[model samples]
Target: MSRAVLVEAPRPTIAAPAAAEETPAQRPSRRWRRAVSPVVLVVAWEAAARTGLLPAEKLPAPADVVAAGWRLTQEGTLGVHLADSVTRAAIGMLIGGVLALALGAAAGLLRLGDDLVDPPVQMARMLPHLGLVPLLIIWVGIGEELKITLVALGAFFPIYFNTYAGIRDIDERLVEAARTCGLGAAARLRHVILPGALPSIFLGLRLAIGAAWLSLVVGEQVNAQTGIGFLMMEARDFSQTDVVLLGLLIYALLGLASDLGLRIVERRVLTWRRGLRAT
Candidate 1:
């Protein structure tokens, strides 16, 4: 018997199921979760103040702090103090950060540099930079110089240490691969070394910024004429707990602002790391 010719029918292609759309209410957002802690703490604080469990003079309610801050802001005192503090912090961070980057580069890239530079840095880092406030006042005369210098000193070590570690920890195989491709020392460093170490460098930057603020707090105490620390101190003297808390809140806000700025910078610079983001 002759085999019958079979005709094939085209198979249908299946489409992927569409993902469910989340309504505004159902959508998962970080904003609400972020507000949760602050809301809870504020509510608890308010309740405690109202109940007299925590005296207003001692802790002060959130509303009282807000009112105090508003009063100072309107008087322009808070604005001036905030501006001075920000300026000092910015100047100090720049000075310390630049120097640390240079030193870190030397120690990380050159054996001679490492031998000469690392030992002193390691030793100097051991000393409590904050405690040097008294010495700084004596030497720098408790002026802007003292605050800037202290902040610089505080910011320096973290940047240097983290940068050195980051550079040293780069994968050798990548460097070797670049070398095998006839990339010169400078080329290898620019293309391979820096990119690999960027994450750690950003981490150092965040830490350095935080340290700068901490040092500023201490430094501002040394005969500070105008700054957030000064504002807090004046409030403390008058037993204005609300104003003191407001000053602290301002400090926290500044630190938060700086850290957020750095995070944005990190995202821009570390685009290759975008792949690591959750889908």
Candidate 2:
């Protein structure tokens, strides 16, 4: 007891933390999966075309379509047609989107505005806008104006409805919280409403772009002298199936490209969205 040693307990060894396994990112795998289905479809299509099960006049092989597209590209016809179609769509979308934003904001924020604007819009939406093409042509003539107007009409309602819905759908609690914090109307709208509505707006944007393309398809097909639809029609008259398919492929590609662009924009704009976070 007298010789009690004040020996310190042996210091515990602290083990080093293990390094995290360097797992590869799944991005490349996801991209590979997306490519797989389309590649398989293309292979099957080429194989079927070689089988002669369907006449070549009806469905051209993918290779033939690519060849025809290349030929058109070399001739500079494809560029001109693509440019015209894109210009019409862009102009129409801009006009329609501006109108929609104004109308949607008014209707969504004010009951009187909603009563005055929403019902008529809903009624008009029930009616087929494409059927109005004949009348549109009669009034506007078969020109650039006709195509642009048709695209505008096609794009308008989707934007209007979606924007209105987005605004109306904002959580009431969030609005109350903003009010409790003494936020001014402009501040509340800027910080709360607009952000809340953006996802819906992007959804509408995608749909509207598709609709614009669809309307352009119909408009261009009717008494059109230029654009991809006209090119397809011209090819049809000569039974140039490859060229016709190429035109269709171009339309599909354009629509896909536009949607991809919007998706990129949405991802950038919605970076704060928690659901986008991965574990």
Candidate 3:
């Protein structure tokens, strides 16, 4: 008996549009790949407890987390925690963002000003935000003010550094051209330099927002009556890893939401710069 061998030859490269048409069909396959592991993990987890591979007390199923979150929501505890976290993040981000933008603008405008302010700000940025928590607790007494302050400090440097970099990197050629138009230094900065720098500034803002969220968690975890971080800390004391994971998941979603909202605002404000494609 003779056996037939199956062989395949590679297809030649297709044109752009022809290659692109396959993308939509492959998208579902891509999505399936992304989802397969999580689905498998959930199934395995459920099976593990049923098969005595994992004890119910030690490892709860994803269903338990859903139920736990639902119970917390029904009792209004989750809402309160989420609200506290959101409020802290919002207040801190606004304060930090405003300060960074103003100071960065100032430093960018004047070399003497940058010399006076930029060095120390850069130095401070090198220090971790969480490393400052103990000092903050000692100085500010672990209240709402402390929490907000921690988050503000956490957010400030990213925005300031990026904004300053953007400003400093503004093309001298553009400045010279603007100067030829009878544009004053202030006018050049406000109209030309700042506008040119907006994209970098927004990138910094996105980064600072992420920093703010992280610092908020640390602030709440260390000392607080409320917020998702506090809930997770308390859950840890009770060995409720599921609750801890749930809190973490919620905070991740909140950060994602905040970043998405910021992106929307950024796009609207920076629409003019889109043509430049500096990104």
lDDT string for model 2 (1-279, tens) is: 488779899999999966554357977776797899899999899889989975788997888889888988999999999988898889999998889988988999999999999999989999888999889989999888899898999899999999999999999899999999999999999999999999888999999999999999888998888999899899989999999888888889999999999999999999987552333
Clashes of each: 0, 0, 0
Q: Could you tell me the lDDT of residue 78 within candidate 3? A: 96
Ten residues in sequence with the least summed lDDT for candidate 2: 270-279
Query: Which has the higher TM-score value, candidate number 1 or candidate number 2?
Result: 2
C-alpha local distance difference test of each model: 0.89, 0.90, 0.87
Error of 3 at 15 (Å): 14
Give the clash count for model 3.
0
Q: What would the C-alpha RMSD of candidate 3 be, to one decimal place?
A: 10.3
Candidate 1 residue-wise lDDT, 64-88, digit = tens: 8999989998998988999999999
